[model samples]
Target: MWNRLFNKKSSVQRKILVSFLGLIIFPLGLFSYASMSVSKETIRKKEISSSLKTLELIADKLNIMASDLTAISNLYFANSSLYDLLKPPQGLGIYEENAKKDFLIKTMINYKYAYTWMDYNTTLFGKNGFELHTYYEGRKIGLDSIKNEPWYAEVVKANSGIVWVSDPSPKLIPTVDDDHFVSAVRILKDFESGTMLGIFLISVSESFLYKQYGNAVQDYEQVLLIDDKGIVISAPDKKMIGQAISSFGERTNKLADESGHFTTKVNKRNMLITYDSVGKTGWKIIAYTPLKELYADIGKIERLTILLFLSVLAISILVSYFIARRLSIPIQRLFTSMKKVEMGNLSERSDVTGEDEIGELARKFNRMVSRIEDLRDRVSAEQEMKRKTEFRALQSQINTHFLYNTLASIRSMLMIDPPEKVDAIIVALVRLLKKTLTEKGEFIPIAEEMDNLRNYIRIQEARQHEHLRVVFEVDEQIMHLKTLKLLLQPIVENAIFHGIEPKPTPGTVLIQGELSDNKVWFRIRDDGVGYSGFPPSDTELDITELVLEQSAGMGLRNIRDRIRLHYGAGGELSVISRSEGGTDVVLSIPAIMDPEELKL
Candidate 1:
């Protein structure tokens, strides 16, 4: 089945449609499943983290409330006036005793109003019985009525400082009903003797706990407050309060961590459980949420992903058919054209046209056929031209030998006459001809080229007799560097014939050479009639066209072309008709120490 599906006999459209469906559907389905799994886990973790944060916030508020109650109790114990009232003179009269009681009652009332968390304030004097101050008024209770209370005994037994106790049973007090309270209890001592004088108690209602954590209860199915002894101190179901946490499920031991979250099953329902401690109260706030309820959105996403995959599979079939047709038609046309060209048909061409890669291939194929036809037509003509050029070059070599032999004969004749001035001229001419005719190489040292230029200048000066002045400013370091032969002499000859000869006064030709940035530079400036018999123009003038237009243009053109051919783009020649009554020809070429280093 797989071989039949992928066989070459299948149409392009069918193959593309099958391939596209396989590529798109398989990965999309796999990715959707993976994404759904990751998203489900992410939602579970985020919900647990959010519940833990809420639980921690409620625990912090509870701790702040406890700390506030403890601070108020400390303030009362530090009050000297309260201490004086509690320890009255032994023989005080009724009026004075009554006055002290009134002062003490006023102080206690003020404290109850000052600290909102403190619901009831009470003091138990060792001898004077207990005084209770609620929001409304003061009352006196006999020592026997409250001394036997469970928290009272606990506070007395742990006698060094303040002790916190959550009343297991709600005690009825005036101005507050049926609500249990968490109390801060401390012992008061006489300032002078450091002896225990009384017991201090500040109690806050348990309804404060519900108010602080009420928002969190709405977010979860059940919220429980459990103590370290595995006892449920508070619960959403009021009847469950004061019961052991094990009664709910098997989660009592996991509350040892200060703050954490976990997943557990209780009564056949999976639940996410989060808990945090409430200060040092040995009590923890635990929130429980059912997993099914928490992940309701994930179910919807799974269904939507299935629907999307089906829609994408249908769209891919239609798109892949048209795309495959568009690509395959051009390729088929290109293959036909290639076969025609293979059968010796050079004019065959592909009509494919677009900006895509297939279009570019067809265009290149057409250009290749045209280029081959052009080469076939030009082959015979190039052969004929090559034969003529070689014949002329051979004849030119023979003429060079004949000229050298003629100059040697003249030198022998001049030695016989022995005229001093004529001998110098003949010697200079022979040196110039030998440098030009001998095929040592195309490149020579700058010093040797300069020597040839000086020899030509000597012959010209001897003939013209003070009509021309030449100046050489060559850097010693660059004299050994190699440059093209005959590069400077032609320009010097053009300057003498066209520039210096035309001027009525004697003209100076300055030849300057320098080395810079791995290139050799030459500047030939003549103080003669400049371009068009005026000072040179500043605009760029094409040296090739300008040289061709002159009477001696061939020499200048030959020099420029030779330099360009040898150095390619690295060689440059420019003619700058100077503004100061002269013409300057600047030439630049790559600096080389030997002829073999020349690229050409």
Candidate 2:
């Protein structure tokens, strides 16, 4: 099917149109594809860079909040009054212990109200079995419940420094209504002995962390604060907190790097993951953005590219159509004219004209048609003249009256002259009959033509009542040259019948032949009435007029036509009437001795 479509023959216009479309479409398509690829890549990189910057900003904000929490936790270390209440009671009674616990609770409540914007809860655990909470309506617990917990060991390892914990068990770290919270825990120690004392836990609601970076989150995006253990510490979705970060995706393993981005699938949706370290926390600020969202602008660019490509293709088709028509129309005209010429309409011509090659061809075609038409007319006329000339030549050769007159003249001569003279006349008559009646080739040697002419002259002289003096001066060098048979006989016949026969006195006919200019020429003259019934003296005669108009019974025009038709430009005939009262006819023909020259 492909071959059938492609291999079929197509017109010039269709081919040109297709070629133009190909030229435009191929490059345009390549450029569009390249541009789209570049644009997509550029947008992706820019989004990645921008996403990384957002993560960094969120990390900075989280770092500031962590610092503030650490500073607030440090405040109790400097408070001697809170320290006195937290100290172990050496000899106090049950009521006194209760009274001291009440005093510590009141002090923590006052401190909590001091920084209401912080909205934090406090938990104090003594190295002894005592514990107190400034949250959950003053709920009290014992430190024995958290003594074996993993975070309890972290707080002791931290010594006087702060330890950040997120979403701890309510039994280990108390909170209101089992709500999620992040806490800063630190050990309280005596400044003088550097000896460990009770533990101080400062807890803030999870909303504190969320509010720090919540505005940076988007609908198709996720933001997570992941701890060093790959645990999600804080997130907009409260349930995700305290879960291993790997629960989001296996690609979370990449978060081990300090900073960078990678692509992954999260919840069956492709996503671009960007992450950065939060200062001093061993935690990461990880942002998960859907791949589609990161490259959203690329979709718009792709649509625009398709539209532009279609527009270019449409314009190219239109332009190609116009150009094809402009180029093919003239050639189509020329083709139409050619078909007419092929069908024998020689008058047909292309009318297109301009400076282009097609126009030049059209002009040449017009001239060619004109030339062909003229040649056809000339050939048609020549054919008619040749038919008439052949018939006249046959009639002249077979005239019974001329034969009877010749025989009668012989009989009269037999009575008046000697037998030898009579025999000579009879021999001339027999030779003339043999030469005229024989079927022979079109060309004969000059010597043979001259012999036949002598035979004809003898018969004419015998038939005429006047004395006829005919002279021959033929050159030996041209005697064997080839010429059309009976060429000279008709001219000599005209000189006798038309030039001398009507004269008051018998005239002499002079016949001369010689080689000139590599050709054979003959001169036939008669000293009798010159230009009496012909065109004026020395007036040039066209071959057509001489053959068709001047070809009376004399046959002078027939001889000229035969010469011209045989030799083309190599042969010529001219007539001149002299002041001395005689007519001269000069005939020139190619000196062709070889048969091969005939083909040329």
By TM-score, who's the top model here?
2
lDDT of 2 at 568: 69
The digit string of per-residue lDDT tens for model 1 on 1-600 reads: 867887888856568767877788789889998999999999998988888888888899878877777777777878776666566456356687677668777877777678765445454454444354554344544445656677677766776476776552333344344355555777777877877667776666666566678666545468877666777666667677667888778556687789898889988999888889987566788888888888878878877887887788778767777787777888878888999989878889889999999899999999998998788669857865764464345425433543454455455555554487667878887788777778686678899999989988886676555788999998999998888777788788777777897899999899999989999889998988865623356664445466556755655666666676667788988877665667788889998887667634
Per-prediction TM-score: 0.45, 0.57
Instruction: Please report, as a residue range, the 10-residue window in candidate 2 with the lowest summed lDDT.
Output: 539-548
lDDT of 2 by residue, 329-434 (tens): 9988899999999999998989898899999999999999999999999998998688557745644653453476578778888777788877888899798767
lDDT of each: 0.73, 0.76
Looking at model 2, the pairs that clash are none
Candidate 2, residue 535: how far the Cα is off, in Å: 71
State which candidate has the highest lDDT. Answer: 2
RMSD of each candidate relative to the true structure: 21.1, 15.7
- Candidate 2: global Cα-lDDT? 0.76
Cand. 2 TM to true fold: 0.57
Model 2 regions more than 4 Å off: 1-9, 34-42, 80-103, 172-178, 190-195, 250-253, 336-348, 366-600
Candidate 1 Cα misplacement greater than 4 A, ranges: 1-26, 80-93, 117-127, 136-153, 172-175, 189-198, 216-218, 309-600
